[model samples]
Target: MSLRKIKRPQGDFWFDFEAFAEDEDGFWLRGPVGTPWRAPHATGSSEVPVVVLLAPGRPWAAWWVGDPADRRLEIDVCRPPERDGNGWQYVDLELDPVLHETEGRVEIEDWDEYDESVRNGWMTADDAKLARVVAEGCAQLLHQRSEPWLDRGWKMLPDS
Candidate 1:
């Protein structure tokens, strides 16, 4: 499957992944090392395998890095994914919750981008509000390690 991240007032990014698995809540996408990805300013391939969960109505997409010694989870706050051609697309809300499992750290990244989007009216007020709520919730889930997607992603990791 293909995943497109649409960032308002910015260039969109796309990734090609395989459909690894699916359940009631969402489907898992697996991208192997060297999977090519393209962004606005740059293009590169993944250095490690990745597992991503894209739920239909969830406000965030969870990404699991497959580096065993440096495994981490990253969640992007977005406007829920929707079908776009043969893949899916979602508007990125800017805020992201990143969990560094090895360090037991959770940080909300890209606050400046979020703020700029809101101040410049790049995103709607309601969307910004929803982004904030989802970011906070995702951070808390990362801290508690309570989200099933977290574990599910780990299980799907390469060589897990």
Candidate 2:
């Protein structure tokens, strides 16, 4: 009889979120998506992310060009049920208008309560919402430009 071959899985090793959580201070650094945000340090930092103001329990994520080397950010988010409401859904935002007047960075301040049905669909739940704000913060803080990264990969993946 001929010998049979076994198939192995591909790609990187499994990521341990629990371990990651134990190491970090907050669950999220850049802040959560959909919820209103305020920039406590927007005018400062020159061209780097200083800080983001997020309601307690929400996640925070941001992006910036780090030391010209391998760089990545670990992110975490609160589930929908855990949140207070649906103010962060994809159909209730106006990103273009928000970033239009800014030089390159987009600073979010005065996060008044918002209804999910009104906000535009610029971002989603899966895309580490904090990262989007961080990216915009970097663009504005440094170059006064902003480009949202919503629905980017969704077009490629099959719908659930």
Candidate 3:
């Protein structure tokens, strides 16, 4: 899915590079592309679905759904025949549900926001489900650390 506006009932909202609200300190947080807050975190060569979850006591989690951005902007995940699996290439996946263990339960902070967005027609039902899938997948990955998502660190793609 291409980048679209992300809204939440509280806290800062995502306007896809446009400033939706003033910065917390009333200083500039946006850039020529979009919010700098999300710039460093962007990991893809083309437009791809992603979910980032920030935990109070745990590390912030990132599900680079499909392709991992690394140092390059490999955001464009293509169809099966064109995909090369150089990155996490789950082309059919969308919605990124971010999950982490919290007091023995998995939690995702944005479900409410997604629900609200879907109800208000700002977001589609499929996208919301995509995000939820990410969360579920993340929980298993975090617990087992057995697959590709196990790597918590990022390596910049050469020439990105």
Q: Among these predicted structures, which one has the highest TM-score?
A: 1
Clashes of 2: 28
Q: 77-99, model 1: which lDDT tens digit per residue?
A: 99999877888899999999999
How would you encode candidate 2's per-residue C-alpha lDDT over 1-160 as one tens digit per residue?
Answer: 0101111111111111111111222221221122222232222122222111123333332222221232222111212112223222111121211222213323443232112312433234443354345435533532432222212211222212
How well does candidate 1 score on lDDT at residue 16?
A: 86
Instruction: Please rank every candidate by TM-score, starting with the best.
Output: 1, 3, 2
Q: Roughly what TM-score does model 3 have, to 2 decimal places?
A: 0.35
For candidate 3, the C-alpha RMSD (Å) to the true structure equals: 14.6
Better of 1 and 3 by lDDT: 1
Candidate 1: list runs displaced more than 4 Å.
67-70
Ranking by lDDT: 1, 3, 2
- In candidate 1, residue 50 scores what lDDT? 92
Per-residue lDDT for 119-157 in model 3, tens only? 876545665564556556555555554644233222211
Judging by lDDT, tell me the better candidate of 2 and 3. 3
The RMSD of every model to the true structure, in order and in angstroms, is 1.7, 18.6, 14.6
User: Runs in model 3 with CA error above 4 Å?
Assistant: 1-106, 152-160
**CA lDDT for candidate 1:** 0.89
